[model samples]
Target: MANIPYREVLGSLMWLQVATRPDLSFAVNMLSRFANNPGRAHWEAMKHTLAYVKSTTHYGITYCHDSNIKPLGYVDADYAGDTDRRRSTEGHIFFVAGGPVSWASKRQDTVALSTVESEYMAFSRAVQQGIWITSFMDEIGLPQDTPVLIYADNNGAIANTQNYKNHRRTKHIDIRYHFVKERTANGDIVFEYIPSSDNLADILTKPLARDAVIRCCVGIGLRDVEAGGVL
Candidate 1:
């Protein structure tokens, strides 16, 4: 592990994710946690990511003039995804002009006792990104409609945002996560329920099968220049 260039490879992957590879966000974010002490398994995972990158060099986000300019967001979370700490992984992506403008995949700072709680935390993160996206759009003279549409797969979390009632199942969740509820109430953002199978943000919260990955890639407007079509 000491001899391997783990940090160097991670650095390169990080740049790729930040610049042109929203599809690699989850993999790179997960592997980066082991930069200080990567083992054989981590190295193997890094190699797999590198191989995927190599295979999809022609893949890039495609934006069309007819695409929707209004920013939309998708958010999801994997409950107890972290093997070492049992923390949830929250992921989000914002789209403009049919292409991803920003996205993120990160483990939650606190352990969530329920899937709903984790989803709520993910909602909070997505709302923060939505606020920023709307602000930028306004500055560029593309002001968005009120109550920015944000999609979530969890009905429980969506209900939480709509209802102010405190229940035992969610009362224990941190006050910070309730920021999403405030945003929803104020019409700054809205959480609409989407089916898990159709949620694009699912790709960012966990490792996916090949078909699911390809579907998500296409959903995010990733296209292959060589193939001249969505990937």
Candidate 2:
């Protein structure tokens, strides 16, 4: 493992994730953390990601020509998923015309006491990006409708956005995370609940089974180009 070029391999994976591979975002993000002191297990995981990429070389995002499809966002979080720091991982993806336009997978800055806090934190970050996407669309003559819709699988987090009253469980949360509540109130964005089974952003928050991976890939417009319209 000492001889392995972990950082270089990670950089290549990072470029792939940023360029056209939303499915690899979480895996690459996780592996990048051990760059400075990677073990044999980390090296094996890096190899796995490379092999997966090789097998899916023909897969790419496919934009369907449907004008009715408008911009929408999905956000999710895995609470205390970082074993080293007890930090949560937040992930989100925004789509327009049936294809992802932007997406991210990042670790939370603070330790969340509950799953709801982790989710709400993720919501705040997604809203910031969501608002930017809406503004950019408007400037490009593709003005999106007001109150951009963002979907989350956590019912508690959705309720937190609507309920301004801070209780014992939530009062300790950072002031910045509360921005999601204000945005909901001022019509900048709206939070809606979706079943976890259907939340495409789930792939970006944690490691998943192969079946789930394919489902999310298809959901977000990634296609098996060599097979002509399959994921």
Candidate 3:
């Protein structure tokens, strides 16, 4: 089947995402959804994605022990981004030692009715992942300080988690998704607003210009190591 090549292509992209290109994780994940019966257009898009990767093959996340910055996270969601189902995509990045250690891009299971709901869902997933990372770090004796910061561009979503008075609009959200509020109340994490320009997670959720992509990659500490540096 012609579609078989599409699956292999997507699988290759996924391997890149998991290995060195966390920046491509979300886009690859989104495109992989259409691999079952890819048309010519989809194949073209896949080629373009591959070309982009080839152009920036040197980029990668680097974790250096020299930096003292505390571990932090950034999260954002693209509201109703999927043209077919109007579903949102969630993107997040976790940084330690001034570099990204973990990140993800995934489509929301449920279609969000509003931008706030989409952002809330994204934040919820980020919180869950944050908890898991915190636990794992603790197990490794690298526990982070309290109030791990999570940045979001959506003010309404932050308000929803920080305050309980907006239930009129959010009452429809599932109880499981409301766990972000609990984490906020317990002081395990704090949600703050970050201007879109500074949201590193944007690279995961959308196609950006080459300059923006390079800037984000640098912010995540992906760089070319010199001969003097550790190999």
Candidate 4:
């Protein structure tokens, strides 16, 4: 681990993640967490990621022009998934023209008290991104006529956010995360539930099985250029 160029290789993957591979964001972000003091296991995980990229080199996002320009979003969180810090991992993806345009995966800065809290935090983060993207779209003369739709897998979190009165249970959460509540009140972003199985952000929230990863990858618009057409 000490001898391997972990930082350099991770940087390369990060560039790919930002440019075209939204599916790689989670693995890249997770690997980047250990860039400073990578263990042997971490190095091995990096090698696995590289192997994945090599196998899916033909896969990439395909954007079609027939669809509207407004962004569709999904967000999810893995409850207390970080082994070292007990922090949840937040993940989100935004799509426009029927293909993923922006995505992120990262360890949360604060530890959540419950699964609902983690989902709420992740929802708030996704709202912030959605708001920013809305503004950007307006600037480009493609203003959204309706509220941005954000899908989440947690029904409780959706209900909690739509509740104007902060229950005693949720009073402990930081006031900053209430941004989602305010935005929702103004109809800037609408939250709806998608089954966990259909939530594309699930792939970004945790290390999934290979089949699951490929499924999410395709869901996000990655397709192979090979003749087989099966990834």
Candidate 5:
């Protein structure tokens, strides 16, 4: 007999992803789609994921005491990543005191015709989350200064955020997403271009090699208690 009900298994995995296993967010999100019609391959994949979790059960986020480090976020999009829908996946992670506290990885709600558009959509979503988180922090007495740094790997998306003039290319985008531009111009947020290789949010949108994944996890202060390693 199977170990757990499919729904229960999926729910538990989702909770883990949200709690302390951002590394598993993409994998769990992908696997969850197969819950309704899980074949043997899907079951095997789930079991493998569980095994990985068991092996790294002691790994968790490590918050530092430093408060001088600025709050920063990285956003990325995998253009046309989904094999079935050809929709991009938007991923973002926010860090404070050198550790990630908020992250998301999900398919874009709308189909973007260009990489710039996909990146713009993803950046906008990150900006919204950034604003909300900043406000929450402020309410809790961790108020940050104006203009949080938001990193995006796409130059076009960064340019779009810094400028308001609409060209034929960007005119097709929804008006709501223009909030990124408004926030940037109003000095509430700043968009910076980061090289794709250095964008930590990349881990959320796509699978990476083992080394890269571990590097990112370490960079964000995720420690493995069992291994006595602070990563």
Candidate 6:
């Protein structure tokens, strides 16, 4: 396995992950990081992702035509999920017309000092995506007028964006992450705290039980084609 050239297969998986398989995004992202140094364990992980895809080939995002057309976002962070570097993974999913239209799962550029900081950065990145999407919608003649709501599971991070107080834990954070705060204040984007159990972005931040993944798949509008509904 150490001598195997795995880039081509990995690239195909990456394409599928971006195109339709939101569930495989985290696995693809994690495995891609090790593509150059793939060993037995890495190859096994790739095989696992392939197996998961084989089992859920019919899963896809369906845009419900008659529903909430405004874009809604769910953002979450796995606090220091990367064991080796202690970096957090940020995940976000944007829903429009009752289905997910865009999503992301990627490692943070720098290490976060705390869970609040990680969540803050995650929300900030979501805001950036939201802003871009809103602009694109405007160009397409479906301009959105309401604020984009970004749901977060952490209360401390939500409070940090709203209050802006330089508290001990958040005082040292970089100024760029506060972009979410500015948009939030202007009513362009709203940060709302939701129960972690209900945050669908959980799927993108880390691996979970099969049941949990199914629940998240439903949350983000990925449905099984066989039953004409969620699996």
Give the TM-scores of the predictions, in the order they appear: 0.97, 0.96, 0.92, 0.95, 0.92, 0.95
RMSD of 3: 2.4
Best by TM-score: 1
After TM-score superposition, what is the CA distance of residue 95 in candidate 1 from its true location, in Å? 0.5
Residue-by-residue lDDT tens digits, candidate 4, 1-231: 557899999999999999999888889989988888999999999999999899888986777789877889999999999888899999999999988888999888889989999999898889989999999999989898669999999999999877887676567675745788989989999999999999999989898897898789888888775744345
Q: What RMSD does model 4 have?
A: 1.6
Clashing residue pairs, candidate 1? none
For candidate 4, report its TM-score: 0.95
Candidate 5 residues lying further than 4 Å off, grouped into runs, are: 1-4, 67-69, 227-229
lDDT of 1: 0.91
Error in Å for residue 5 of model 1: 0.4
TM-score of 3: 0.92
Whichever of 1 and 6 has more TM-score, that candidate is: 1
Winner on lDDT (1 vs 4): 1
- The per-prediction tally of clashing pairs is 0, 0, 0, 0, 0, 0
Q: After superposition, how far is residue 151 of candidate 6 from its true place, in Å?
A: 0.7
lDDT winner, 2 or 6: 2
What are the C-alpha RMSDs, in order, of all predicted structures? 1.1, 1.2, 2.4, 1.6, 2.0, 1.4
Expressed as tens digits, the lDDT of each residue in 153-201 for candidate 3 is 9988888887756466677775744688889999888998999999999
Candidate that beats the other on lDDT, 2 or 5, i.e. the better one: 2
| True-structure lDDT of candidate 6 | 0.87
Q: How would you encode candidate 5's per-residue C-alpha lDDT over 1-231 as one tens digit per residue?
A: 265466677789999999888888888877887877777777777888888788778898877786544678989999999888899998999988878889999898878889999998898889888888889889889788988998889998888786767767667675745788888888888988889888889888988898988877886567986677565
lDDT of 1 by residue, 102-194 (tens): 999999998999999999988888898899999998998989897889999999888889888777887767575567778888899988889
Which sections of candidate 3 miss by over 4 Å? 1-4, 226-231
Candidate 2, lDDT over the whole model? 0.91
Q: What TM-score quantifies how close candidate 2 is to the native fold?
A: 0.96
lDDT of each: 0.91, 0.91, 0.82, 0.88, 0.83, 0.87
